[model samples]
Target: MKKFTSIKLAIAAACLAASSAQADTILGLYAGAQYWQVEPEGQFGSSDDQQAAFNYDDDAQGSFYVALEHPVPLIPNIKIRQTQLEVAGSQNMSFNFNGTAFDGKVSTEADLSNTDLTLYYEVLDNGLASLDFGVTVKSLDGEIMVMDDDGTSEMQELTGYVPMGYLAAQVGLPLTGLSLYGDVSVLSIGDHSLTDYQAGIAYAFVDNIAVDISAQLGYRSFKLELDDLDGIHSDLEFSGAYAGLEVHF
Candidate 1:
């Protein structure tokens, strides 16, 4: 009788342990690369010495990000997702005077980069559809260089904080271990605002390794403050493509 009671108690304890493991939360980590481009629009300058036209070009910018997500018990089939990104790049700008390029180097190079941190609640699981709504805090730090016709130059560095809110949604469909997804985000920084949209597809070959290809379209309009140059301001617009990989554990 004593042996039977001990055996029953051990079985009950094992079942309880298994149930606890099933209720434990799981976390996911994602890291990837991004390509970015920038183009400016709108007018710059006040009355005298004012110009309405400008030209600019961007090669390809690189960026990266990490995200964390977990399920919410109050809302069935819903989770919360948060992410942060670091981006950097350079661009060339030129000013045109009545179809003649200015003898002076009106062009500038910018080492503009920023980090974005966001928190949002996501709904829909089962790998079919998901929606996220949240707010983002941005920290920007960079320098812009302006050159003169005689090849002389000066540098201006800017560092500040900005806040913005965003919403993102994604839908997935599977075909031969591959899935397609789409996302969009809108941000407001000072007097400037931007809307970014992207669509992509990923292939999962083994379980922990995956390859993704995505294209991005963006629209932006912002005002900037500059020193040493009177009546200085800017309006920018850009779009591009990106491809990267993800590892899950």
Candidate 2:
């Protein structure tokens, strides 16, 4: 999704306050990256009854995030995340896209992804429990392209941004160095509904005040339902397991 913006002053104030009162509380900086092997299945066209089939083989997608959290109360913490959604497959499709009909055996590619800049408030963050809620602007800067083996090609550029609601929660097991975490972002309005979420277990190899390293394994699922916006109509789902590394400093 192409993302959303314009509410930076509140977060800027939080950062400023955190900088001024550095030694009184915790100021956490963290980064994480993951690789997901996705299986895609969906349909695309101008309308529901006039769509074409999509069956994609297994493929890998990359996602990463950087976040900053301080002792500030009301103003939200900041997390910047980038995810790539790319998958390709071959099929015999006959459908109408953007009001034009194309019929043939073609190779299709769907690239739907964006960088999410999120501002969230910590609802609860203690030793054993943590929860966060906020909003993000997902910048969709990708496209969908289809080509027949006979040199005929067509592409639909997906370039837009939308605001999504965000939620995250974590619960740690005592003395186990293990935790359960889930994160979600969703937007549903009018004729569009999009959602992405991940739930996983994380084991901390090294947990300390100054630095922490963790290994995480999780399942991620993303679904997109778009209705004739910008000439492309699509219903897509991409999901799979992921292994990731996260570090906090």
Candidate 3:
């Protein structure tokens, strides 16, 4: 009778451990917000030769994301992110912006705010590292307004959807609440291309049984090269440092 009771108790313990492990992989939610201080570079116009250079100063922008993960077989996780970016500058040059000719001192304002929807699968998620790869569809809905000294202005609309490839990876230090991570999305089709990437270090300040909070500092760069996708032909870039907080549950 003693031998039979010991066997039953061991089986129950094993079942309990298995149940706990399965629960850990069932669901997860992550949310984060970032503040980016970026410096603008490059020019915009109807062509490479007739472009107006931007005299932009450093600007601050905001971005945020929410992601949901599940362990369901054959199903991928989803993340939605929104980014805010805009800059204004003045230059004394001759340029043709979308068939409108501008001379003398002209002020230009460009807004490049966009939203991203990503569907990814977690390929590897061990204790020390993780990797995720998938597809991202970015929606850009902004405009460019240029005004000359005569108060005449031209508005060029920038509205389009771009598809890109996404990949992310992270490496964690054992017994330390620190990690290094990077992610990127890229696309190149014909004469137009877009690339956005970030590399950063994160430290977990709060580690709980059901939640984790982390602070991340990193560098982010975004480059956009277009061939009249929205009646605007331009090459532009915004690159700089960013800081953010993340919460995972």
Among these predictions, the greatest TM-score belongs to 3
lDDT tens digits, residue span 1-249, model 1:
999999999999888766654433444445555544444333332322444333445445555666666565543222222222222222234444223333443655555466667666665555566677776655667655555455655555656655556566655555555565665556654545555455666665554223233333333222343222332344434444455555443
Predictions: Cα RMSD each? 8.4, 11.6, 3.7
Per-residue C-alpha lDDT of model 3 across residues 73-175, encoded as one tens digit per residue: 7888999999999988988887778778888999999999999999999999996899999999999999999989998899988998999999999999888
Error of 2 at 92 (Å): 1.7
Candidate 2 achieves a global lDDT of 0.85
Best-performing candidate as measured by lDDT: 3
Tens-digit lDDT string for candidate 2 (1-249):
123233476677778766644632568888999999898888877666777876688999999999999887787899999998888888786755655556677787778877999999987877699999999888898988877777777788888888999999999999899999999999999889889899999999997545789999999998888987677677888999999999988
Q: How many clashes (backbone N, Cα, C below 3 Å) per candidate?
A: 3, 12, 0
Q: Mark the 10 consecutive residues where model 3 has the least summed lDDT.
A: 16-25
Number of clashes found in candidate 1: 3
* TM-score: model 2 vs. ground truth: 0.87
RMSD of 2: 11.6
Error in Å for residue 66 of model 2? 0.3
Choose 1 or 2, whichever is better by TM-score.
Answer: 2
